[model samples]
Target chain A: MTDTSDLRSPTPDPYLSMDLLRFTTAGSVDDGKSTLIGRLLYDSKSIFEDQLEAMETSSKARGDENVNLALLTDGLKAEREQGITIDVAYRYFATPRRKFIIADTPGHIQYTRNMVTGASTANLAILLIDARKGVIEQTCRHAFIADLLRIQHIVVCVNKMDLVDWSEEVYQNIVKSFREFSSRLQNIVEVTFIPASALIGDNIVDKSTNMPWYQGPTLLYHLESVYVGADENHVEARFPVQWVIRPHSDEWHDFRGFAGRVAGGVFKPGDEVQVMPSGFTSKIKAIYSMDEKLEEAFAPMSCTMTLEDEIDISRGDMIVKPNSPPEPSQDIEAMICWFSSGKTLSGRGKFLLRHTSKEVKAMVREVKYKVNINTLHKIEDDLEFKLNDIGRITLRTSAPINADAYKKNRITGSFILIDEHTNETVAAGMIL
Target chain B: MNYTITHLKQLESEAIYILRETAAQFEKPVMLFSGGKDSIVMAHLAKKAFWPAKVPFPLMHVDTGHNFPETMEYRDAFIKEMGAKLVIGSVQDAIDAGKIKEESGARASRNGLQTYVLLETLEEGGYDAAMGGGRRDEEKARAKERFFSHRNEFGEWDPKNQRPELWNVFNGRKHFGEHFRVFPLSNWTEMDVWQYIMAEEIPLPSLYFSHERDCIIRDGVIMAVTDCLELLPEDVPEKMTVRFRTIGDATCTGANLSTAATLEDIIAEVAAARQTERGTRADDKRSETAMEDRKKAGYF
Candidate 1:
């Protein structure tokens, strides 16, 4: 449990023991997603005096009736002038229980890439639904994308309670409709509902007094207490080698360590490991995190491992327990979300596929189908994969890729396709 | 702690992963070390990322010729201790070569001129990637920056056309003339940097700690009395206990009045600080889109 003994105090180090929560906010135009984020930052006292003063001046210049909280976001000059978020913007704040990183994304239907990019690393997602509109097509699209990204927890903020007269029946109805829509999403572990008024400061940082029928925690409270400890897969031991560390200096001339971030499970010094692609087995001599020799390392920990046997190993090799090895195949099937607007992904197209630390040239054998995110249906007739389109594809790689299903390991299961001619990242792929 | 990693540890690991990725992806990678706390943390993470092996790339500093004397001292000591190569891009050299002009007067600062020197240095070194310590929480414009920020041949940032960065999969692909500016500390906040500095026990310049210095209050900001800064007739210098929240050109970086001498004290002071760290940076005060304008022109 998080120690909130000194919840709001500045004594004895409140930051050392605190955990971190990274979440994404998704809502359509004027649904108050940015306003909700601004409220969270403002009410938490995260916005400094200078920032607030600047925001106030800008708000007045833009002829806003109130100090526009949404202006706190929309960083780029283009974004500010257009009054819309063109790309993903990251915002940071902290409470006594946790530090929060909010990936604030735009909600326009055309800006689906921004939403996907923001939802990629988030542990939780905040989908704001206008109390009047209830669950709309944009809400379903956001929910579907969040589910496709495998976000564990989602906090559905039914905002604009003030506009809806703080009606409990309205909030309940929206909750029911959202449940019916979200039941089709298979990957979300938890869905929580809260009534909020970002403009009126209700049920965001503090519990709303107007909505007394709601007994759930505030948005901030839910964000602080959400269980994301088990989000990383700790069952499969997978370590994709990122670099080969070797120093020729006299102090340590013979040290050859394999450096990588652990993707899954716990790895100890005496654990027997297998090198992927080569299938060579070796025993771990030691694990060193910087200068200290760690007894054990696990998922998400960056460490260097020295093997007892000096086998031919380099970057792009995976070190794992010999008993459970990932499927090594040249044929790959994955769900890809296209990102490039200048080019469209076509069948029989060839590109560079990067997964883990390995890079292989892959040719698309076929376009399986494109997903209609709002409807949650796969369209089989249209095979054209354009910008912001989520579809499945089969590809044959130049070399065998050792990968796990995206459901099992996010690190090893994810890949990106890069256009050979333009060198732009065309699509993000999830291994099936 | 229940076997879970602390936020600092997690941030450190993420940064290390990025540093490693930069080294593996780019042909000629260099770290833009500004002798600030953020850059210090990046260098330390780079060391940890490739243990036993020396940091693969050189450390480059665009010398504004108006830096704190303590910064240079610390920079030399740090590079020598790490046994890493050092590359200097001198703004003074650019001025001397008639490529850029040095601003004159009380408000004159080489802060804006460092961009030209930095770009020239990157081009001269043929570096395809330069790692920075830029954080999203520092400024408004920086909030939208990616971990792998691309630059055109002219070294300008196209914010609207930025590539989509997802998960931990960073796309470093670029054309021949294009290069990437990689920021490993993009997710960290100012408070996080201080906490990580405390946890790692990394050494910093004494300017960060409280010291007695002659300063003049200009527009509600405390500016350290430096030789490069031309004093106005109405300016009066007074000795006070002050510390620097950020280290930029001596002409532009402001000193905050504080008695926080130790890292613990600094952390506490930062927690209680109501002003953003960049509030002291006079360069950013020029306009609302100051950072954005400079960034679009390839400013670090």
Candidate 2:
């Protein structure tokens, strides 16, 4: 029998542990979001026999002459028939270097909310443009959404190079136009351009034999090589306590650890920390994982922390560095991505606002402006924010909230608005 | 001191953060524990999420009473070890009291019956939030699931009207009688889960590893011939060296041929496996969209 106690501290092999990469894919109906994902899975050897068999069966049933690469990601039957992505479909694959989560989002205007939801947490967004089309309105819309969501890295894959006879001028022109447009968006930090065909497997996973003009790394190579370490907030120490861990067992009876994942910065055992809302100060006693205690914990680590002094702390409460604390405010000015279809979000509508671990009643006080995604301009006259629309809004909450700017901290700076009557999520907002 | 977080660790942190959000936001919350690896991992994360302090909520298992014996044993011991409360809503009890009529046929399964017991358990416990180990990578319909999934009074999931989950902010707000099903492991894949389990060194039931068991071949699936499973003359019982890909009712949950004797070996096996774990599940084989249909009916 495997001893239960011995199972707690088994040594881990780091080489076998896979790294995760969260990315978003954007493409018009014909630009091949599904084909690119299918190609990635196919070439990376992530596609399974059953999935391929299912694809083959579905393709045959649909009376298609060839395997529909789009069928792999166009999950909904409606989407498969319509030849468009109606909603965001998340797909997972892994390479030796990194495990990937692709949020394949629709490129149309109606599904912009889905794009926003997909891009919000993504570190990188793969914006696909058909080489023949150059830069279209849909391309601009997707890029604008990626920028609005504060996605740092943008890989502009100029797809279907095979269709365009692998023209370098077309690729360069598209790249220049995307750069010019992206320069206007404040959130986009880095943009890389690659010319490839998702259908023929050119520069997707392997070097394209046809495209001798292209010298950049393959799409898979770029995805695996991109430095995502700077993606997280390492400037501020934010630990939102998920739960208070107090094992009543005899061995750990007196342990009072604050269980949470570190959202930003680095937290050491001896670092002085302040509990949010209550404003109580304490020093970290220990940072414990499942098997052992650690001297320090950094951003994106879920570990239990014990304070030197017994401070009253609970879930929704934050532990941060004393010197650089997040501003606690009841009035929040934010950019809201309206998602509900019931009614347009207007001023002074009561809703539930969830920030980090805390939820409180909030009312939208004012609509500052609505963003015209295609034009990249703000329309102030339109006070009504409808579904799939991005707008600026002011909110007043029932209680004070500890928050940072969405740019500074993705974890503490974001919130969602829930409809009180219907209890549906109405909007997603980022604190400005 | 420098702390480096692996990709799986980052995902775990995100999940723990969501779990904390559920506990903090909801008035009363409980975790859905099915004795599956995902649920086991979720429970482990929950324990780590609120370490030093007790997990703020109890664990609810909607027991169909047709589970693998090892699963029940593991569940009981694991709950006891974690010092977390475990609440079981028996489908057998529901059938005995006539709350739900037991299906009597070749296709009869208590799988659909567990949803009623689960919903009733949540209602009785006043649990406004129920944490589940659901992941988007599991099926096609689950691809669009929100981190905080809302359910109506009848516990039906309206896939058409899902809440938009942006960033790490989860909306767990619900009215009385309604509840939210929160999936912290939404971003995690099958390999990620196995790797995390291996990295964290979490204990699992022996059935997950290669074991000799008397199982019957029915409908191209190896169903464990337990007391809970009714066998017909057509079903041929045989002893095989097989391991369960997923643990559910002994009748529907299928086993895979494997030589994996250790956790590391199992992880390697899963990493190299060509098909998804759900490919072995007979319940999902009922239709092309069987999982979707069940999800719509509030079957977690």
Candidate 3:
């Protein structure tokens, strides 16, 4: 009994007080994105001894100038052999301030799908730029995708400062150029700039003494302190029914609860809500978060809600505040990013569209225009939406889907197009 | 007012969402239970995902026949307590049927052979989705794993051709004769699992706690002295107070010298420990790409 005391009145757990930050990194192999991530993990003491030992052994065998940090992320055999990252890899690290999940995405033009996939879940994006080359085509392309994904925060890391002798002029030039370019983008809300050398370990986790002239929060500091709570839409109440809980057992015979994660706003018992697609009104009876009754629930919290009335609701139906109900329509206009290389996006192409918990058959009605990712210009001439091409298209669904504009709500506005025949995710769309 | 929740709560919500998605998407699904802390947490989350109702899927265990007796006892009691169905895939039966051959020598382990039995069990049971406790933070290859990992008709994973998983919307669509290995714990680390276990008061096997046991030191690893392991020339048996960081095949799972009798002590030990949790996993030490290779061939 005395030994079990630790499990009972345990002092405050360090993890319970910490928050979480999910950010994605965008850059080419030459931009030292891997090294920057490695330095952050290494300096923060997240890299364990066994992993470091394995990395050292692999580095020696490969005959590299510094234990190639790229080996830390390139997990697959093909990626290691070819010295490139073919897919998005997730890495975790934690500080006293917050726990961080890094979506390490490759920078090649062909792998734009990976970046888009990584950025889709991230609250922030880290754009890496080489000091020698201030701002290039690759930089603009990465920034455009991040903005298109509606990533609220962007941290421009000006790396490889050791090669330029920690020049403040080069960092400022890159920052100015990036600011000028990002001003034209639509959805990015905040941007931060930092000067550092990933290989030499400057300004990543610790404050660098080398750059006495530069003054700002370190990369890790900024990440730990950034305000991403406002990123979630807390004004519009929306809950998409994912699954219905029905217990046939005698103990819970009459149990019928609608389960889902809150996509936007706050919900509480006694709130009036309207069921979508079949306009029905009901009052929230109770909210349960894993058997524990909650006073209130908000975005990103998975819970079960019981309505006052027995409404015919299933997985595809949504419950929202009656005043702010989304417009239910069969026609949807969206910005599409084609992901499948085997199949190209063409007009009148039919695919399965998954938005929220609803699966509907949709047909591409028209390809309005394609955007050249490099120049961030509307390329109306080339309507051919090939792999990794961003374009605007009109889609008509087999059924009416109640959706909000992407700018208002990320969860309700975004959708994915699945190839009907191959079952591959062909494109990601943001409702315009 | 602060609108943010703690990291633990956030991770719990995310995992619960994935578990609910699995229950809704697949006709037949199962949870792979190993009686380890990770699996214990996963099962606990599953119970919460559909409360007032029993877990929709059965809990499957691929018995290597080289497990600690304590593990078998704990697994049976856990299943009975959860009021869930249990399914076991026996590796020994596969070996007897000539489906897989047993390895020879002192370092022989049935870890790789369990994959054959697992795949066969899934085929026979007609389960289209198998939810595992595999975490991305555990190994290098797993770092690239998706929440809904697709496997072909041959039950092989194509890492390069994995579908893009974006946001909380998990694409679980698969063709007939194909299945997906869903990992609701993909974002969790070993520390996160332990912390959640402590917070949730999830019951685990007694093997995780410190106790006196017969052990042998091999290549700087404290291998438990079990009947299934063949003694090498350098292997010497001794009584030591040791605990396992991970629970796997008894012949391959290594123990660490510790006195962490409670969850609190274990958490403190893990925080100060210098090595990864899988560092003591003798199976992963077989080769550089051991886990990756095993996963490609359909290992959970």
DockQ preference between candidates 2 and 3, better one: 3
Give me the iRMSD of candidate 1, please.
2.7
For candidate 1 chain B, the 10 contiguous residues with the lowest summed lDDT are B1-10
**lDDT of candidate 3 over B1-300, digit per residue (tens):** 567887888899999999999999999999999888889889999999998788899999999999899999999999999999999999999999898999988888889888899999999999999999999999999999999999999899999899998877778888999999999999988878887888778878999999998898998899988878889977779999999999988988889999999988898898788899899998898888888999999999
Docking class of 1: medium
**Superior candidate under TM-score, 1 versus 2:** 1
If scored against the real structure, what TM-score would every candidate get?
A: 0.97, 0.92, 0.98
Which of candidates 2 and 3 is the stronger one according to lDDT? 3
Q: How much lDDT does each candidate structure score?
A: 0.90, 0.83, 0.90
**Which pairs clash in model 1?**
none
Query: Chain B in candidate 3 has what TM-score?
Result: 0.98
Docking quality tier of model 3: medium
lDDT of 3 by residue, A1-432 (tens): 012324466565666577899999977789999889998898887889998888888888888867788888998889888999999999999887798999999998889999999999999999999999889999999999999999999999999999998988888888999999999999999999999888888888888899999889889889999999999999888999999999998988888999999998889999999999899999999999767888889988999999999999999899999978898889999998998889887789999999999999999999999988999778988788888999899999999998889888999999999988899999999999
- Kept native contacts, as fractions per model, are 0.76, 0.70, 0.72
Cα lDDT of model 1 by residue, A41-114, tens digit: 87777899999899899989999888777778889898789887888889999987799999988888798989
User: Order of all candidates by DockQ, from best down to worst?
Assistant: 1, 3, 2
